[model samples]
Target: MLWIPATLAAAAAQTARNATQRRLTETIGTAGATQVRFLYGFPFALVFLSIALTLSGERLPRPDGGFFAFVVAGAVAQILATALMLAAMRERSFAVVTAYVKTEPVQTALVGLLILSDPVTPGGLAAILVATAGVIVMSGVGRGAGASWRPALLGLAAGAFFALSAIGFRGAILALDSGGTLIRASTTLAWGLGLQTLILTAWLLALDRPALTGSLRAWRPSIAAGFLGALASQFWFLGFALTTAANVRTLALVEVLMAQAVSRRLFAQGTSGREWLGLVLVTGGVGALLWFHA
Candidate 1:
């Protein structure tokens, strides 16, 4: 399915974005780094929406109350999730935090089922559990620095928020009355970014002016992070448009593997034998998911 490739692309871009934001967080603080994604990313999202509209030859989908509600919920939840994710990264290795966040698929499956009526077949549920187990294994739960409960809790909280965001975004996409999948997904991405940018901008301006100004002063790297963030969100929304959020999120667990690469290259973190074993499980679980969905 198109969603498969879209999810993969999203995962790759997101890993890059996370690496960039991780660097930014050191200088700008967590709030500033969090807002960098939305503020810088909003314009790029507009560009993506325009391209999708032109390619699809579709008008902008008119939003009703349902669209606004869903988009707002997604926007807020994602803001919280990003902040928590970055905070957790401050305490743990990049790969570990990535593995922690990958736990969202199960939460996403449940939330998507309850909130959006998105069904998860028994096979899909089993695959999700297996993939999630791989994440726990990779994270080396109860071992080493990762055993610290503070970062673990932050990561888990981030996963829960991410789950809510995925469900909200999928609901928003499905709520659209007109336009093809590409256009609808693009439209939703634009709205979600706009809302997030506004909310974070206001918060920064009001309470964290230094962090806000810090992000502005680092415009060069901020632009790079923004582009990557927008790229990730574009494909993520595309996947959500094509299938249930659970399927998209489960496929997205591949990001942990990608993040491991980033961690080794950028953070100088090495994988253990246990992590390698977990890698096989993640691969198997993702393979099983793809087969089941197919």
Candidate 2:
């Protein structure tokens, strides 16, 4: 299959994962929910990474100093981003949270350009602006008079952390000297997930022992969320390995549409006019980017 289709599938899977996460949050609370997902998902990630390594017939390489640091940083950033996102979800509508999350593409591109020194064409810049405008519209930024800026600010922070995580993971993958792509990708994912589990687990225990204990006691629902989260991360890593972070992040905007569908069905709310317009703009922007790049 083409990369586009694969990316679309990944985006769809990510959307489903987000919906599951949102549901998980309702029962476990945001922090507790995240702790459960990461803690439970850690083992699954190890298993999947091991399976990928075995199938590829590649030996895992010992990560160098830089590689280790990158993975650890990425894992930490992802954990922070997820925590912020879940918090935002608790405070805002699903549509609002998703629209903010879609800003990941823009943040990723900018970070890649500045930090990684990735080259950007004029067309790419234009696409970024258009997509950003779409996100602002979808967010109802100025329309909600007296609406607190907390959600938007929190969402943006989450997106920024997510961008950092993406950059960190990609850096780790590139730092690996392993000849096998599958092995390198899997190894990076394993380390990242492992680090995330450790850090988040420690943080939860230190600050919120009761929530952590509650989540552990009610492990049934958390198991599914954990499994789905691990599965989604695997696909996300695969896509990142195959394409530039900018491209993958841009395509991942499909998650917003998927989230919208879920919100409509599960939450029984239609999109606002601004959100509909924003969706159109975002679609146009994404199409423009794809066409220009192609």
Candidate 3:
């Protein structure tokens, strides 16, 4: 379905947006860089919502307490996940960090079942486990020059929060009582980004004024990254509205291969034999998931 391609597009956009944000982190610092996505993304999210409303002729759904709970949970968990990931980046290589965060498929399944009552088929569960094992094999846990548990802890925490964010966003999207999936997804995006913008802006203003100014000075690239971030989130929410969060997340394991391809093309890096094997396993697992589910 469209959710499959939509999720694929989100993964690619997220990779590109993160590359831009990595450069931003060097200038504005991590927290400020994280804020850029919210600050700049909110306007684009509003635009998306406006377009969806006009096209669908749907009024905004009246949000209930569950909607607010889910949205706030998604917003706060994502922010914390970003922060922890940035912190882990300081301690681990990008490959290791991403692999750690990729554990979200398993966690997402558990969270979705627990909180949203989303059910996973037996085949789907098998695919998730196989893909997760491949990801762990690819992580190269001891391949680092020197290792510490700090980054590992941070990475796992980031993965858990990310899982929470996925469940929360899916919950938020499903909580809507009216509108098409597109309209509901767009509406959730608008509210989520708006709340995140307010929260991060207030924090930056109170504690990190210089970083805010630095982001302002680098507005050109910041806006580019921000726009891409919003674009990715839009499609992500749409995917959530269309399918279970666990399925969306399991398919998203493709991003690991995407990141490797990006690094090879842009940074003159290459994967090893073990990584290739891992790629094979992940591909096989994901292929089986789609095949069985189809």
Candidate 4:
């Protein structure tokens, strides 16, 4: 399905965005870096909307009350999730934190089921479980002491928020009264980024002017991060428009391998044999999901 390639592309773009955001976090602080994805990304999202509209020759879909509710909820939840993810990045190796956040697929399935009535067949449920178990294996849950657990807590918390955000986003896409999949998905991307930008901008202006300023001073890299973020979100929304949030997110687990490659190449972090085993499981689970979907 189209969703397969869309999800894969989203995963690749997201990996790049996450790497950029992690670098930005060192100088901008977590929330500051988090806002970069929305603030700098919003303009690109608008561009994506324009291109989608022009190409599809579709008018923007009229948002219903349900759309507003879902989009707002999605926007806010994603903000919290990104902040937590950056915080977790500060605590652990980039790959490890990513593995922790990858747990969101299972959580997304549950939340999507509860909030949006998205159904998961038995095979899909099994695939989700297997994939999640791989993430748990890669997370090294029982390792370390004292503050070592902090990253795990933060990452899992981020995963939970990310799950909620995914459900909200999928629901928002479904709420549109008209427009083809591309138009609806792009429009929702614009709305979500717009809300996130406003919310983060207001917070930075009120609470942390310096971090906001820092992001601006580093705008060169911020723009790159923003573009990647927008690109990723656009594809993610397209995938959501085509399938259940669970399916989209479960397929996105490929991001774990992408992150691992980045970690090894960029961060010089090595993956243990156990982690390789986990990767196998994750791949198998994703393959199973695809087969079940087919």
Best candidate per lDDT, number?
A: 4
Tens digits of lDDT, candidate 4, 22-80: 99999989988998999999999999999998998888899989999999999999999
The residue ranges of model 2 lying beyond 4 angstroms of the native Cα positions read 1-3
- What's the CA RMSD for each of the models? 1.2, 1.7, 1.6, 0.7
Q: Is candidate 3 or candidate 4 better by TM-score?
A: 4
The better candidate by TM-score, 2 or 4, is 4
Clashing pairs in 3: none
Please estimate how well model 2 matches the true structure, expressed as its whole-model Cα lDDT: 0.79
RMSD of 3: 1.6
- Model 1 vs. true fold: TM: 0.98
lDDT of 1 at 254: 93
Candidate 1 collision pairs: none
lDDT for residue 97 in candidate 3, whole number 0-100: 65
Candidate 3 lDDT, tens digit per residue, 1-294?
888999999989988886677667877888878888889889999999999999988899989999999999999999888878767766655655666788789999998999999999999999999888877777665565565667877888898998999999999999999999999999999999999989988998999998788878889998998899899999999999999999999998888888778657754567878778777777877887898778
Q: By lDDT, is 1 or 3 better? A: 1
Over 1-294, each residue of candidate 2 has an lDDT whose tens digit, in order, gives 144665677677667767777877887788887786688888888998789877877777888999988888888888889889889988888877988877888788888788667666788768877877888889987566565478888888998898999888888888888746667777787788788778877888899887788788768877877887777777777766776677777767767778888899987768988899998888877787788778
Query: Estimated TM-score per prediction?
Result: 0.98, 0.94, 0.95, 0.99
lDDT of 1 by residue, 123-188 (tens): 989989999999889877687563497888899899999999999999999999999999999999
Q: Which 10 successive residues of model 1 have the least lDDT summed?
A: 138-147
**What TM-score does prediction 2 earn?**
0.94
Candidate 1 residue 243 Cα shift, in angstroms, is: 0.5
